[model samples]
Target: MQIEMKNIHKRFGANNVLTGVDFELLPGEVHALMGENGAGKSTLMNILTGLHQHDEGVIKINGEERSFSSPKQAEEGGIAFIHQELNIWPDMTVLENLFIGRERRNAFGLLKTKEMKELAREQFEKLSVLIPLEKEAGLCSVGQQQMIEIAKALMTNAEVIIMDEPTAALTEREISTLFEVIRSLSKQGVSIVYISHRMEEIFTICDRITVMRDGKTVDTKRIKETNFNEVVRKMVGRELEDRFPARNPSPGETVLEVRDFTRKGAFENISFSVKEGEIVGISGLMGAGRTEVMRAIFGLDSIDRGELYIHDQKTVIHTPNEAVRKGIGFITEDRKDEGLILDFSIRENIALPSVKSFAPKGLIDEKNEQQFVDMLIKRLTIKTESAETSAKNLSGGNQQKVVLAKWIGIGPKVLILDEPTRGVDVGAKREIYSLMNELTDRGMAIIMVSSELPEVLGMSDRILVFHEGKISGELTKEEATQEKIMTFAAGGQ
Candidate 1:
């Protein structure tokens, strides 16, 4: 399949999403769509997939002008899109999700369960995925869900697959397997449109690259002809100084501590502490109990046995409300589900945690709330039309900033951040790191749980590695390296 989209222009209520964008995909080639958040990468793809109609454009597939009316039509035409957000029916079984809309049937219109299972198994086997067909989709881990989505796409036998942020929730091993599958698919004459903010993966797996800036196609070049710095410069339309900001540590007394924290079958004996003006990074592979530990600390999950201390005083927090009252803020890893209310305005989400402070006499104060929300939005450099915009309308990086803003509004002494910059762009990532530095400088302790090793190494004053529900090793910033962190994360001595 060959796809050529020329001079695509799309607008939604005065928001010009895609402007004169040109994107092309060749058969058996992996093409990367690189951009900062809201750069119209997804918008252009949506137009191509028939999710949204372009106001002005010419779409040609295999030298024939074509326009799909729906995603189903696009898929039937040998094009499949695996969205950034997994579209899984939690209540349904794995097999049901795989063949939801396009189930096979017999001549009598009877369901072909056996045939569907066999087909799903074949696709999963090809991709090295080991998930049970009868298992509930919601019970699967994020990585498993991602694999399920990939397998579902493959089952369509799509000639052109658009994968957006496919590895955001996957582990290193899972990513390796996914890359292998992508390579195999490419070898089989399948073209892939890979959309991701991870520069390493883009350069590693993609054959060609198309850079977009502010809803415009900046450039398209062969992957071999372009470098990381050049791609980033094109995406952000400026010369980025550093991937991470410089850190200068100034230690203080302990602010929060967890002693012998244990959650059966999750994590155990997790003893750690964060001092005033310190950033403690927890590094581990997926399902290594890093998120579980943080959830327990924030009272989102219960611990079978543990001790939590605030300012050297033993504290018992049975719920999130109690944790918040104790001056602890938590920014969950799954921001869409846990951090913000998607339907609510940005002002509402940002002011939710601190609403009581603004309302002194049991009455809501709109003016103060708006001012507070506006300040954080500006301080965090959140790009939005206004505070009235819905949380779901913003881009991924902006949504992340909103999550951070929500937590920051609470004025907590200790903050817990899990996968803070999972799907964020390079420019926003640096801004988040700078914000972290500023927070620590103001005597706010932070506990960051991250899977990205460079981020852990760059921002952490101390790093703790988790393996098999235990703290395998701890290292200072001066001594920590990628190899050492991986070794400890893999349960090394």
Candidate 2:
């Protein structure tokens, strides 16, 4: 079966999320959608899945126009979508979740629990997904839960399966397993819609690729015809000036030093140091305690015992405010929950961290506040109509930039960024890379935590591999090979 969407147009209020976007998914082919955040990839998928109605479009399944008013209609048409945020009942067992809506009834008209369990196990095996059949869905790793969601799509025998950012939280081994499963599905004549930000995975799995920008179709091309640089150019519509700038550390003794930092059960024995104007990247699995170490550094979490020295001065940081005063800044993974107040305007959010800095005679200086916010936004290239716009209305990438702007406004010497580009699109990623290089060049000691291997490899001056919250080994940029990083990250100790 072939799925074709022609002239897809969708709008919300004054913003057109998808405009005249045309796409297609051939039978047994993995078609990938590439775009910046807010480019409407998810919107188009939603329309195909009948979760949202399109203003104008012709959807053809096997050359016949089809209309879907709800997910049931789409499912009946052999289309299944697994969103980035999995839609599953965490409290329910896997068997119950698999047969919730399509329950088997007994001959006497009662529930058929035995049949559901048998069917769920069959589905898991068929999809090569490892999930406890009777366990609660909430008690699963991010990758396992993702696999379960994909398995559910398979249980329906979907002709077209759409996956959005399927490997965002998956480990390297899990990603390999998923890629194999996708290939098997393609071999078995299932068309796949793969949406992801990782370019390496795109090249590894996708046969055809389509790039979208600003809700408009860029072009669709064969995988062999496109390159990473070309795809990045199309994503941002401009060349990035520089990604990693020269690292010239002032080296005024040791600015910060960690001695045998340990977080039991999560990670242990982490020891490292960062001088002024140095950027250190921690590379590892999603739970490698890189973020946890940063949390402990910023005094967000309690550490059993660890020595922290800032500017050659021993310090005990038990609160974020103390960390802030000690010239340390932390950017969280979930920008919405920990970074910014979505309801507030960008100006207000940036001022929230160090609003007192702009105070004159104990009264907040409105002019200075605006000046501080404006400087960060301009430097960060935050895409917004105005600073007055609510941060919630911005794109995911832009929202991340706002978070950066909020923290950068404080002028911290030791800045920590955790998964800074997690849910961001390619274009904004380029911009973030640009800002990081520029900021580091201007003498800001930095610590970056990233799950993406390429990013850590490309941007870090030195790479520290973490295994269960401990530093397995440290590698300089010249020595930080992806394979080496992976080895140390996967229990190299």
Candidate 3:
């Protein structure tokens, strides 16, 4: 399959998304789409896949001009799109979710359950997935869910597959397996359109790359012909200084501590302490209990047996409200579902935690609220027209910033961040790191749970590795390295 998009123009009211963009894909080649969060990468792909119509453009497939009316039409034309957000039905079984819309049936219209199982098993075996067909889809971990989405796309036997942020939720081992699968598919004459913000993966797996910046195609070059710095410079339209900011630690007394924390089947014997003016990083593979521990600490889940201490005093928190009142702020991993209300304005989401502070006498104070929200917006460098803009209207990086701003408004002594930089662009990531440094300088302790090793090493004062629900190893900032952390994470001494 060969696809060519030329002189594409898209507009939504007054906002122009894609302007005069050109992209091409050849059979049996992996093409990369690189850009910042709102650079129109996804928008261009959406136009190609028929999710949105381009106001002006020409689409040609195999030298024949074509325009698809819907995603189903595009799929029927041998194109499949695996979105960044997994579209899984939680209540349905794994098999059911996989073959939801395109189920096989007999001549009498009877469901072919046996045939579907065999087909699904074939795809799962090819990908080295061990999920049960009868298991509920919601029971799967995020990494497992990612694998499920990949397998679903492969089952379609698509000639051209568009994968957006496919590795964002996967672990190192899972990513290796996925790369192997992609290589095999390419060898079988399948073309792939890979979209990701991770420069390493883009250079490693893609044969050719297309860079987009601010609704325009900046350049397209062979992967071997370009370097990381050049690619980033093209994406952001400027020279980026550093991937991470400098951290100068000034440790104070312990602000939060947990002893013998045990959650059966989740994590066990988790003992750690975070001090004021410090950053403690938790590193582990997916499903290794990194996120479970944080959830329990924030009172979102139950702990069978544990002890929590705040400022050298025994504390008991049974709910999130109590945890907030106790001076602990939590930034959840799923920002769309748990962190913010999508339909609400940015001001509403930012002011949610500290609403009572502005309304002391059971009446709202609009002036004080506006000033407070406006300050954080400017401080975080969130790119929005105004605080009145809906959170869903902003890009992924800006939404993550709003989540951070919401937590900062509460003024918690200890803030817990889970995957703070996941799916964020390089430029926004540096800004978030700078903000983290500023917070620590102001005597706020942070406990960050991250899957990315470089981030853990770059921002942490101390590191703790988790393996099978236990603290496998602990290392100081000077002692930590990628090899040592991976060894601990893999349960080696």
The lDDT for every candidate, in the order shown, is 0.93, 0.84, 0.93
Task: Estimate the overall C-alpha local distance difference test score of candidate 2.
Answer: 0.84
**Clashing pairs in model 3, backbone N/Cα/C closer than 3 A:** none
Model 2: runs farther than 4 Å from truth?
Answer: 71-73, 85-141, 239-252, 343-345, 358-368
lDDT of 3 by residue, 314-424 (tens): 998888998999999999887877999999999999999999999999998999999999999999988887899999888888899999999999999999999998888
Q: What TM-score goes with each of the models?
A: 0.98, 0.88, 0.98
Q: Per-residue lDDT for 170 in model 3?
A: 93
Across 1-493, the per-residue lDDT of candidate 2 in tens digits comes to 7988999999888877888999989999999899888888888988988989999989988999986899888998899888775677879887777776888998898988787778888877765667778889776656677778877788888999999988877777778878888999999999999998888889999999999998988999999999888887887787745444444444444678988777677657778998766778888886778878888989998888779998778899999999999999999875766888999999999899888888857899998898888898898888777899999878767888999998888888888998888777876777787777777767788898888987998788888998877778889888879889989998864
1-493 per-residue lDDT for model 1 (tens digits): 9999999999999888888999999999999998999898888998899999999989999999999999999999999999887899999999999999999999999999999999999988877888999999999988899999999999898999999999999988889999999999999999999999889899899999999999999999999998989998998889898898898879799999999999899999999999999999999888899998988888889999989999999999989999999999999888887888999999999999999999999998889898999999999999988999999999888999999999999999999999999889998898899999999999999999998888998899999999999999999999999999999989897
Cα error, candidate 1, residue 423 (Å):
1.1
Error of 1 at 261 (Å): 1.0
Q: Candidate 2: how large is its RMSD?
A: 3.2
